[model samples]
Target: MTAAEGHGAMTAAVGSGATTVVEGRIAGTASSARVTVRGGRIHRIERLTGDAAAVIVPGLVDAQINGYEGHDVNDEHVDGGTIRRMAAALWARGVTTFLPTVITAEEERIVGSLRAVRDARALHPVLGHAVHGAHVEGPHLSAGDGARGAHDPARMRPADVAEFHRWRQAAGGIVRIVTVAPEVAGAVEYIRQVSLECLVALGHSSANAAEALAGADAGARLSTHLGNGVARTLPRHPNLVWEQLADPRLSAGFIADGHHLDAAAFGAMVRAKGVDRSLLVSDAVALASAGRPPGDYRTPVGGEVTLHEGRRLTLRGSELLAGAVKTLDECLSWAVAAAGIPLADAVRMASENPAALLGLTTRGRLQSGAAADLTVYDDEPSIGRTPANVTIVAGTCVHRGPSDAGLAELGEIPEELR
Candidate 1:
């Protein structure tokens, strides 16, 4: 097949220098363009043409994603096939890189998931190549039944550094973020130790302002799904959630699916934390891609993950989300249309801020010398109209929809995989 048939987009040497000039808007900016790839890296960007059919933005980076396309990373049987499918599904959603988040579960299950991720890397090197790393969301978190969400009560233990170390080793050093509750015993030290190698985030906690601040001081730099994974109600002032948001040193992620936070509270965060420090997480589940039917949805926890129905349906679950029903791109759309955030700012929340939290300099931006991880949206200055028309990773086109895949699924599998 021809290169155009394979990628839906044509790649030809442009200009006198054998350069590939991708002319399109950067984010929502109506007329800016980016030119990339020289010596196997992004060379430069310039505004060369009028607004193209799509806006070119960095491919999204979601720091917290539990599952996708019917695969839960925390499930008892998180096999390599599941991880591969999850990665493929995520890429189809315009995610060039993400942290395959594993939430609270049994120790053995956690190890199994980590090893599955490791084995996926071994079997499909493209997955590892796209994966920013793993985000181990907690068994060493809050013990409060309400606060810990769907975390298995039996496995809820004190912050165990050795266990985290073991998980890191088992995953072939893919642990990039660990979210814990500062209120847990020895949580501060665990945060300190883990932050030395990977990012530590505070979440699923009953901690007050002081405890939250202590975690921040101990090197906790992120708050996972800031308001979703906490108690039902918090103290009027200086609450842990409020404290984490008010602190300038900590960057917080939020589930912008509109179910996690109300319009007012979500807007308040945007105003309080500013776009630079506020990240957007899909917090989606395995059911996100194919979509879930009206029935009981099972979670790692005992009961099923349910969604209420009405003019609006709220996700019903303890702490872990109902299921992956939203993509990071969709979350960005909600942040813009629902919360009234700027299109560019919402894009940054979905990409740059999350990348910063993960300490991933290579995967977030469209700057010269960075990886050409880009997404082209079909619609315009309004984010709601922008659909992911094309996705490029490392200057290579991985997805092109009907214009490329022709109804069949497309994959980025490398020849030497496994």
Candidate 2:
């Protein structure tokens, strides 16, 4: 669907006058609840029966997404239309809100992409509501092998406040998260400065325990994809992995796509961070939803990449992963299956924790006065076994799966989903 069509569909759904009430067993609670939504905000939540078969949870929130459905977020050609398509695709996957993450690139490319996203938010209603903000992931990361991942080493550089100001201006101050290498020159001060405006996350680094702690002291509060962007092997003592895992002040984001981390490692990290401090991120790329066959394919960056079995993308002929390719729902399923986390806790990691991390109070909860963003599914914990039956954004049914006959009877598919 076109951008205008997507916006029009979302407007029609949310602008309707009637109230919407959904009944299901609420996540993180024992009883089933009747959630009342009116004028796009939750009007009331009344506990009724405790025997509902379906599960209801707050809509998933993805803090980091590079691209999806064959549209690259960092591509210079990216525009408002691309943003709309991405938003619609995410909505179908049960994401009510997300950040279009822009990774390390040249100054002009980064600024242009940021401006495009800002403009998309202003021009498209669905995208405007779904895109909470922009996530800037690099240009200030480590250049060493494994640490750099697929980011271009030639464009990598130390932190610069002036450059950051330009990016903020380009994005109209919508940048909510910035990831940096703690070991970069002037990075600690950069974190201190930017933390005043947005969250500062450490990633793509080879920092030791001391350096990581220094970054934390200077206001870095998060580790971006903790175990992935580091060397394959490290010294046994005082390494970046152990350091970040042990730091109480830093919450870590993990890509629970099953391939990014081993099951044992994923379980250990979750245990270390505990349920309250850990968050889930989908660092997915365009190829994630492109429907392309598994094999080698060239990309704008990362050169030639290979899509392996289970949709894992990696640098051609190399052991390094290009980026994640799973939706947050799939990641949640992996968390439940691989790490043995409770389904409720996995949902929280995909929703509440990231919302709290971003200071978004209204979007992540299913309480009175909060936005009516929610997902309905069957009792199965595996995401694929029980895909979102219905996804509501701001009290409007935007996506109704084949099994959601009730929702489909209410209305046709939104143009955004088409």
Candidate 3:
């Protein structure tokens, strides 16, 4: 069935209502529960028959997303319509909230992208509701080789409060996150200033332990994709990785897709950061599941890249990774299977932890008074093995898998998704 048809079918099944009832085993709890949703908020949760096998968890919240389904957040030409399409696609994957991350680029492009996202949110309710805020990942990062990732070195610059003000203004004051290299000149002061308005993260850095601690003291609370953006080799001790992991003041985000970190490394990170302090970030790019044929393609910043195994995208002819291609749902699955983390903890890392990081109180929970954004899976161990059978955002059933035949009949695929 086409995506549009699927969406319509799901919508018809879950008509607009003052209240709705959903029955399933709640994540992080042992027994099944009947959750009542009213006015887009969870009104009540009551224990039900424990035999029900379906798993219900809060919808995933992604802290960092560059692009998806052919829409690049940093693209100068990106528009509101494109952002809306991306929102719909993300809904189908059980992501109810996310940040549209803009990486290092020219000043004009950054402002334009922020404005485009702001306009998209205003014009499309779906995009607006799903987009938590804007994440400025660069134009303030280390210029070293591996530390820079796919960002253009020519565009790299020191943190500037004036530029940040312009970006926040363009984004309609919804810019919630900024990533900077702590060792950069005036970075501590920058973090101190931005921390009042948004969360600050440290990334793409060659900072020493002292510098890392200093940034944390300055209100830089997160380590963006901690283990991924750094020199290939590091000093055995007193390295940036160890520094961030050892610091309890900083929570760390990781790209849990299999390619970003091996099983051993993933386990180690989860151990160091502990479940509560770790966050899962997609860090996906525009070509994610774009259905482009498996072959080499030149990206605007990542140089020549290859799409392999139908999922992995990498810089061509090198062991160096390019960017992530999986969604947060896929990453969650991998986290449970590969990292040996409990399913409940994995869900918290994806939802609750990030919500707390962003200071969003109404989201990332399935309790009373919380927003009724939930994902229902078919069975146990739903992490990597099961897809979301139903995804509801704010008490609205926005997506249902093809298995739900009771919904309206399928229709043609949406042009945007195609």
RMSD of each predicted structure? 5.2, 6.1, 5.4
- Per-residue lDDT of model 2, residues 254-318, tens digit only: 99998899888998899988888999998988887735689998775476899998788999999
Evaluated at residue 115, the lDDT of candidate 2 is 86
For candidate 3, give the lDDT.
0.79
* Runs of candidate 3 exceeding 4 Å displacement: 1-16, 290-293, 300-303, 381-387, 406-418
Error of 1 at 6 (Å): 26
Which lDDT tens digits does candidate 3 get at residues 1-418? 0011111112122333466666666675676776777888888887664356667789889999988887877776887776777777787777889998988999999888888778778864545677877898988898887788777789998889988998887668988899999998889999999998889999988787788889999999999999987877778888889999999999999999888888789889988889889989999888776356787877644768888874777788866677878889888888888778788888999998998888877888888999888877766576445456677777766677765544333232234322
For TM-score, candidate 2 versus 3, the one ahead is 2
Top candidate, metric TM-score: 2
lDDT of 1 by residue, 1-418 (tens): 0011111222221322323455455675654554655643578765543335546778789888888767777778778777777776676667888888887777778888888777776764456667667888888888775577766667789999999988877678888889999989989999888899998999988888899999999999888888877778788997998898899999888888777887789989878988889988887776665435655666653346665441122235433444346778888888888889888898888887787767677767878888777766555443433335566666655555433323122233344321
Off by over 4 Å in 2: 1-16, 28-30, 381-387, 412-418
Worst 10 residues of 2 by lDDT: 1-10
Q: Report the error of model 1 at residue 20, Å.
A: 5.0
TM-scores of the candidates are 0.87, 0.92, 0.91
For residue 68, model 2's alpha carbon misses the true position, in angstroms, by 1.5
* lDDT by candidate, in order shown: 0.72, 0.81, 0.79
Positional deviation of residue 126's Cα in model 2 after best superposition, in angstroms: 3.7
Q: Where does the lowest 10-residue lDDT sum fall in candidate 3?
A: 1-10
Quote model 3's TM-score.
0.91
